[model samples]
Target: MRDATAEKTETALDAASLVTDMAKRARAAARVLASLNAEARTAALRAGAAAIRAAAPAILAANAIDMERGRSLGLTHALLDRLMLNEARIEGIAAGVEAVAGIADPVNTVAAEWERPNGLRIQQVRVPIGVIGIVYESRPNVTADAGALCVRSGNAVILRGGSEALNSSRAIHAAFVAGLASAGVPADAVQLVPVADRAAVGAMLTAQGLIDVIVPRGGKSLVARVQSDARVPVLAHLDGNNHVYVDGGADPEKALTIVRNAKLRRTGVCGAAETVLVDEAAKDQLAPLARMLLDAGCEVRGDAATQGVDPRVKPAAEADWDTEYLEPIVAMKLVHGVSDAIAHIERHGSHHTDAIVTEDAAAAEAFLSGVDSAIVALNASTQFADGGEFGFGAEIGIATGRLHARGPVGAEQLTTMKYLVRGTGQIRP
Candidate 1:
């Protein structure tokens, strides 16, 4: 019999070594990737898609190994579900590559330009962010998504996925490298941390000057830890406790439909609605809405007003207000009006995505303008908070931070602007 703790510790150490080595290689590869033309980059993305599709069987097999280990370790069904990658998921990764290929390359675009009085022309151009270190959880799909987006944007990527998904991540990384080779790009452009140790994350976070940026995509705990320990710039969200407000002027049919789909369509997604705010004037509608959620097998935690409306729901604790329960359970509340609803969101929201289902233009405008969130929706589901939905094709994750970027962090968001100045022979007098 093996000691699980020791096995986990050794595995983590191995991962740290792998990530540290890969980071060095990626830094060198970034210089080469930066010089490639748009056509060459697009070709690489297309090749990546083809490689992922061709390696679906191997990817699935690797996922199976990770899944088996995860279950034996008593991982939650949610985590296990995220770790398992099937043929369809493999195809989805391929589709992401294809989508990235179609989009205009963000690199080399002119962000802004200006002419100075002294015959000087200054132009701001977008450039790759260099080496991007991504640390994520059980979702194996992120391996392909982050790898492709970084490559397309001319940045070398180093991915460190969860210990439970190590095999799956490695298999995906292999396909990505093959894709890079098919396009004649350096295989080191996409690297996966070999060890699955938690310490690997610390190594990644502290790789300050070596790594340009560290983007952690996972639960709040992982992101928070990275934010605290990271020496480099971190682009992450503390939580995804999103919300949906059904205003009094809302179309009952539309509100009911959006709420149901938002909560039940897929509770595992970060943009899934965790709280439902109903207008006080429309409080009576709660009974029917609560039934819909319950019928869909969702567990409802309600405030006093919600508990009065739906006796089936349990009383919500104070902690529930600030929770990001990525499950089929939602916090239900009744608001006096739009202002009240906005206030509630401002206080408890994770600034991820918030939607308002209202027919009143004034109320809708107020909600959209007042809410300080990355994605604000009107007459739509909070689940629409996705890069694909925004027409960016695919995204590494949504950035809730105000600096650098916000919302769905696509390829364009991954770049920084540089000033290119052209001047005649003139000196300042």
Candidate 2:
């Protein structure tokens, strides 16, 4: 009989082999994808959208299974909402795919061109990063978005979704494959692992040469794991421990409107505001702000000052200042001004998204300039931090890292650049 250690080693070996095969196939497909012209790739995206629309019933059914399993596993209401799929949501996904198809192709375009002193012509051209692996959780929509974005940007992708989302992801992946097949694109160009094993995630992380970059779209724990263990570089989507500051010079109406939408528009999203910082000048309006959120069935936790303004406002713990709270809950604090608000956000925020609501242009600019987040907003809802809202169709995720990509990762951001040169033979002086 095999010993436990030996069995473990064999399993690890099998996982590694599986990842290696997938990566090799993906690399070969990427070469084909990179060679295809813009029209061909666009047609593939259109076809994928059509396939998704055609497969909506099957996709819905698959999502139903996932939802059932999620509930059985006792997933939180927020996660269950993310895991659920309805007819409208499926159509929205299809529309997003079509929207991506309409975006200008980023491949092979010259970003800049210059002439050298030696009469050599030089051009900076955008090109695919090649073979991207996406790891995500809950939302099966990512399966479609990541695959479409990678294909649109002329790269092959390997997707490893969370176990709770396996069935839903498979259905969407089939639609993507149909789209690729219809366009005569290699089906291997967009692959989703068949298993739900954590071993698969580890395999992708360690498959450095095989996968160019790993883009992880999930909660903090998953991103942390990928960051710590992956041999490949990671594009991290951070938790939305976001904030909105109601500046003292703020217009009260706009402040109320933006704050309400930022916090309640969709609590489960990464852009949803988790906290609010009110300028002490807005102290008179504080109770009204607390009341608005409370009326919307949101639980408001606040500091002593905020709690004093509204009896319904619960006392906040220090940890509340830093929590993501991806639900109908928000923490409120009073700041002296834009500077104090900026300090609070800098200290506790995840640097994902932050907004300042004020009619004061000076305060707005200060907040925008001071907060070093992926997305900074002025007099607008933090929910506006979406890629679609940014007119990029669908995003892989909001990258908080200041590397190759930040904010919404669209097709253009998915690519790296190369230098193209044309030179006449000139002897050195």
Candidate 3:
């Protein structure tokens, strides 16, 4: 019999070595990608989309194995949904890749140019971020989206997906590699970790020079861990503790439609509203909304005012205010008005996405300006907080940070700027 301790140690070493090799390959690939022409990058994306479409059957088959294992492990229904894949979803993934191909290339393009009085010409040009490491959970679609965006933006990527979706991610990654080959791009430009060991994630997080930036997309716990532990710089996709506020001046019909849709529309999405706040002046709107939620098979947790309006509502815990249910459960509360609603959101929101439904322009403006979340909406479902919805094709993730990237992170957001100076031998005396 093999020594279990020795076997585990060997496996750990293997995972670490795999990550190191992948990172080095990715760094070399990134240099090639950064020097490649934009048109070639777009071609690779288009080819990848076609490859994804062609390999749908194999991908779906691999997903079935993941689904079986996921069920055996008793994963939550929401997580299972995120892990599940069908032909339609495969088609969507392919279409998303193609959509990314349709976007204008940002790399090497001059965003700003000026001539100084010193006879020096300066230009700020967009460039690839080089190598990116993405550690995501559950959603296998991220494997395709993140890889495509990186390739489109002329960067190389190394992905470490959740163990539960390893098979699915591997299948998708194979398709991407095929596309890269077809387009004459470096095959290593889009690589995924072949192993399911958690150690791979650690290797990636600490890969500072090898990885230009790290993007984490998953539950708050996962992101918090990556943010706290990673030695490399990070682009965090924090919790989707989103909110929807119905102002006193909101149109009742619009409020009902947007609010219901925001929460009920594929509750697993990061944009789903976790909390709903109604202005006390519009207190009459609360009961109808609560009744609609209850009728739609959604659980409602409410504060005192909310409970008074609807006896069916369960008493809300204080923690519910900051929760990201990611299910058909929502918290309801009543605020004095827009200010009060804003205050509640500022205190409890995850700075991801927030929406306000109102016919009053002033109230809408106030909510829009006051709320500091990445994506803010007026009279629309928070579900619109998507990269594809933002017309950027597919997103790697929604970046909630206030730095180089925010909102839906697409190809343009993946690039950093560089300065090019042209001078006629004028020395700075």
For model 3, the superposed segments whose C-alpha errors exceed 4 Å read 1-13
Q: What is the C-alpha lDDT of each candidate?
A: 0.89, 0.92, 0.92
Top TM-score model: 2
Please provide TM-scores, in order, for all candidate models, with all chains considered together: 0.95, 0.98, 0.97
What's the distance in Å from true for residue 101, model 1? 1.1
Candidate RMSDs in order: 2.7, 1.0, 1.6
> Which one wins by lDDT: 2 or 3?
2
Candidate 1 matches the true fold with a TM-score of 0.95
Q: Quote the positional error of residue 240 for candidate 2 in Å.
A: 1.3
Give the runs in model 2 whose Cα sits over 4 Å from its true position. Answer: 427-429
* Rank ordering of all candidates by TM-score, starting from the highest: 2, 3, 1
Per-residue alpha-carbon lDDT of candidate 2 for residues 37-95, written as tens digits (9 for 90 to 100): 99999999999999999999999999999999999999999899898999999999999
lDDT of 1 by residue, 296-351 (tens): 88999998888886678999998887888888899998999999999999999989
lDDT of 3 by residue, 1-429 (tens): 999999888877877788889989988888888887878888888899899999999999999999999999999999999999999999999999989989888889999999999999999999998899999999999999999899989999999999999999999999978987888888899998888888788888887777889999998889999999899999987799999999989899989999899999899989999999999889999999999999999999999988887788999999999899999999999999899989999999999999999989999999999999999999999999999989899898898989999999999999999999999999988
Candidate 2 is scored at a TM of 0.98
